[model samples]
Target: LPSQVSDAYEKILSRSKDQSWTRIILQIILAATRPLTLDEANVALALAIRKNEPESHSKLKLELWLGKNFKSTVMNLCGLFVSVYDSKLSFIHQTAREFLTDSEPEGTWKGSFNMAQSHHPLLQSCIFYLSFPDIDVFHPPFDLIDDIDGRIKSYGSTEYPFLVYAAKNWPLHFVSQNAADANAFRIQARTLCSATGHQRDVWAPYYFEEYPNSTFDDWKVWPDLTLASYLGLYEAVEDILSKEKPNVNLATEIGRTPLASAITQGHESVVKLLLDNGANMKEQENDGRPPLSLAVWIGQEAVVEVLLKEGANIDAQDRYGWTALSLAARSGQEAAVELLLNNGADIEAKDRFGMTPLSLAACSGQEAVVKLLLKKGADIEAQDFEGQTPLSLAAGYGKWANLWTMLRGFVAIVKLLLEEGAAMETQDHSGQTPLSLATEKGHTAIIELLLNKGKESKLSLSQSISA
Candidate 1:
């Protein structure tokens, strides 16, 4: 099946009147994280050919080359190997991508397709597209346009259709291929980094436009190294480090170091490289979160191991006083929780709310973490500042609210807490018992369980009295 698919792909390429352009389009589609819209693909192709020109000139040249009927032309050129659905380009089948990317074709196409190598051209196109003149005008200080969304929509509609994709995805393409040794690639990367104004202008609008509710205030203080680290560009980090040692510990407005960026992004290699270059393992963010805590919360197990082996503080608390174990348990990061516990993390560490690992795990409906904490002898009757015990927390009491579907998790956790001799009559600061809390939340199963257990306890007590 794959051989036949590969053969068809080769024939499609072999028969192309413009083999280079067709291959570039196909490769762009193959490497794209999602299907590219017609506008995005058209702009991508334009950038591939006229990358050195201004954005306007590139569009003009593209229009001239492909004509107004470019959609049909592109489809006809790609032929049976590709398809267009709702104006988004993709391969005809999933196997086409798997076969082409997994290995080379059998005959004339042998040794031709390298999935990683194919990203090189797309990378070039994206960087060049980002580098176009006046591209940074959409960002702050220069962004005089009051109607930001309207302006962005208008610009994208009339000009630079691929700006958002290029701004956001350049790093993925940059890191996908081995462009480290290539001096041109290095220069291009550095040039983009050095153009801080241009960088923010292009990058921020794309981000804010996509996520309308997110704040961009703290984003202004991001240094080049921080951005590179956040983007997980390993080669860019190496290049920046080797050129001149920028402060590895230098933090952003939010106190996120390059190490923090790498850690949160799950870039283990970048994290290690930053660490070797004197990235502080103990450097806490503004919130007092250490590298280990960040790794644990983010569920970067390998990065968590890296930070631990390098001597990250196991019990360092953030401003909320939550330690790595506390975060892991709450987040249901069972592996990270186990790792921290094995490394001597305090099992009874309290957050600002005086919630223990068990309390948090139970409150968050983390069945696995709750079970693990129980096995590790977590305090079943541990009370928070609100006087809510683990059983009370598992009963869906206090600030925590369980969805109807998630109540099953609460039920299981309640069962575990009860099996461990958790006191059902323990009242929170609100004077609510576990059974009462369950009843308040309409958790009928948990209410019934508590009532049955109460009866069992009373029956055992009466029998002992009779004896």
Candidate 2:
């Protein structure tokens, strides 16, 4: 017999011939990279279901379709295998996802669901949905939603669920399309650009909210070549560069060049193209991370190597005085740490907080990195701005949300720290010792390891520190 999960998915897909709402909802959710809120799903379904139909003629039809009972309908149809988590609808199990996406040799019509190319249609929908009336009010630059008269004057329709989703997810869908498809897709995308705010204004609020790291107000000000370069759209990048001269060093609002963006994304071809076209390798964002530092921070080994080969400053520091080596060690990126060390990185380099690379690696439970640092003769008793040693930092980690995962790795980390001659009695600015911090967090494994290491540990009088 087939598994229970497979049976459930088969049953759902089989209902597609019946043209049920369940199939439509599932298609939308499965195609989406991000989870859809219930409100987003309801509004989106209205547009998705009427895709091939003529435009609407009545408010009553629209109202009925976007009814309050949409959630109940989904629950009734697929509650066994689907549920909302954190306000976004998603499949209940990994088996359900695998069954839906992966096809068999003798697949039926329902199993032939085209998931890889799913984003193409969704991209079309987003462009169409944003083209509707009253979307400008949501754009905020127009300030049309500020007053009652402005709302009435500007808005023809104001149900915002579909608008909210379309505004945030258009780029996600576009990026997934192939070069030929993406280039053709830009026809509709560029059509919207002629509208007020150059099309970006409609999506700006949601974009800022979703991508808080984005430093620019509107990427339209930057050439399409710049964005294509950042997204690793190799064909599009070549096409754009062929048409235009090299703007490889062109920057966005916060001084983030195309090279920095590509390095941050680990886009190798794009980085090489920008580099070949004379892009500056040392460009930093407004937040102060140079291209090399960004690569190391995210553990992009190949990109880091390329930057290093291209003569990037191996020891570049951000505004916070954090070096690439320190960032790699603290993030537990072993390959990056090894590469940096092999290239002559400062193993004990301290940041503004006075926390060395070794201390951070041990505190973050990076066993391999800690061993590597110790082998390189990193200071065992180095302290931070708060005078917390590597042992104290490891003990402080008990207060983290991932206590179990950290605790599991940290037991070993603590053993290494002790063996490497880490000072257990070292106190932080709060006057608490490493032993006191571990005891407070109830890390019996680390506590036992500390005691068994044959060191006379002492606790401060108050013992208020924790990981």
* C-alpha lDDT of all candidate models, in order: 0.77, 0.68
Which residue pairs collide, candidate 2?
396-467
Which is the leading candidate under lDDT? 1
Tens-digit lDDT track for model 1 on 1-467?
44666667677757767777777887788778789878778777766665364554354444543534667768667777788788788888886676565554465443456777777777777777777665546643335435566666667646666776777677788877765423447656765665354655665566546444433444556787887787777777888998878999998777889999899889998898999999988799888888888988888899999888888889998989999999999899998888889999999999999999999999888999999998998888889998999999888653334455155488788888888899989998999999888888877778878999999999999999999
What's the lDDT of the predicted structure labeled candidate 2? 0.68
TM-score of each: 0.84, 0.62
Model 2, range 237-260, lDDT digits (tens) per residue? 655566556577778776768787
TM-score of 1: 0.84
